[model samples]
Target: MKRQRAFFHTLRLPRFRRITLPLLLLLVFTATSYSLVGRQTATVPLPGLVMIDAGHGGYDPGVMSNGILEKDITLAIAKQLQAALQARGIPTAMTRDSDIDYADSGTKGSSSKRSDLNKRLELTEIQQATVFVSLHINNSTLATRGGAEVFYSEQNEGTAELAAAVQSELHKIPQMSKRDAKPGKYYLLRNQEIPSLIVECGYLNIADERARLNTADYQKKLAEAIANGLDSWLQKNK
Candidate 1:
């Protein structure tokens, strides 16, 4: 009883009011986060073939919110994801590395969207990707809604499985909720012969989400989650 009372007394310092509470909260959260990550890491399957597509490049801006361009965010997250996967010895491919709209010298790419898509479509011939993932930011008529969503092309069963893996990984994050995978007709998913999924990271229409999407830290987290999902799929499927 005396020892317990002394422990309480130590926490009674004035500094405890300002620092102890926050510190204790941080410790609790950090432990919880670490525990969750360990669980996800164990569950993720690192499949052999992984391909990444940054949606709406070059002539297309994709979605816009508060003037934040979806193309920019997609590319940033895509690159970060690539690094994360590569670090784990997972092979991956990206459709385009530079801004599609302009050349390296800042000259315009294809003037027409149709022509631009035609060029993007040329990527299909490169190689048969085991799984194709198109990265995109979401847009909505309502400004209050936001969250990550995964969609698979109806043409392939593998796509559905891959989407589920990704959705599960995203849910491991602190604020992200588990969104169910659904069927969709995104051309990248439908046209590609390989299993493919499209990830709508978050709705940009919501001001808070848009700001979050624009930050590098959030982008890093997005990549990590994606890599985790793909890794999860690969570990089990391959």
Candidate 2:
């Protein structure tokens, strides 16, 4: 028992207590903080800045199906996507973080929708974003049509390759339809000088897909897939 007594005596010394107590408290605090946040802090910085746009907010809901608003869903997914990207050490910015729009009523001769779009585009320029990803939910008259689709603007040279990379990653999701990335002429994409694309996450009219889109777990999965795609593209182009 002499060895045990000596060990206990050393632990009780002022110098030992001074160092060990603070370290113990720090360990506890870090554990608590990590548990509360549910995400580890990111340290390394990725190359490009990504601008995420949650399409259609406030008065413009985009599409509504089975009591689900496209604006709400897009915002939810966009926030999740931002988190996912940040977790991977990628820099990200969002056009809207809440249930609001950038439309200015005082702007003469411009429609509210046009004003909102202009504001979103202007923010990208102001932020110097290298890539833009607009998130939206698809609507279809035929409920059977479901699955995520990616469309890139031909205005930028490498946009098609980026879209294809994202689409390929999205296709890996279980039960996700394998859709080819196509060229789109969307105003947001057309106006952007950087690589840009619109991602139609899923069909809101489809019963199963709509149900999945509404759930947090599925939204997280979708965000992870998108993040993975972006990471892949960045790795190749970097």
User: lDDT values of the candidates?
Assistant: 0.67, 0.77
Query: Cα deviation of 126 in candidate 1 (Å)?
Result: 1.0
Q: Write the per-residue lDDT of candidate 2 for residues 1-238, one digit (tens) a residue.
A: 1111000000011111234678767655654211111323222222477788888887678899888999999989898988887776667878777777766755433476788898789767755677899999999887476889999999888888899988988988888877789999888988889999899999988888999999998888888888889877876776
Which residue pairs in candidate 1 collide?
A: 44-232, 45-231, 45-232, 45-234, 45-235, 46-231, 46-235, 47-234, 58-100, 58-101
Number of the top TM-score candidate:
2
| Model 2 TM-score, 2 decimals | 0.78
Runs off by more than 4 Å, candidate 2: 1-46, 106-110
- C-alpha positional error of residue 197 in candidate 2 after TM-score superposition, expressed in Å: 0.8
> What's the distance in Å from true for residue 146, model 1?
0.7
Indicate which candidate wins on lDDT. 2
Instruction: Say what the RMSD of model 1 is.
Output: 18.5
In candidate 2, what residue range of length 10 has the lowest lDDT sum? 2-11
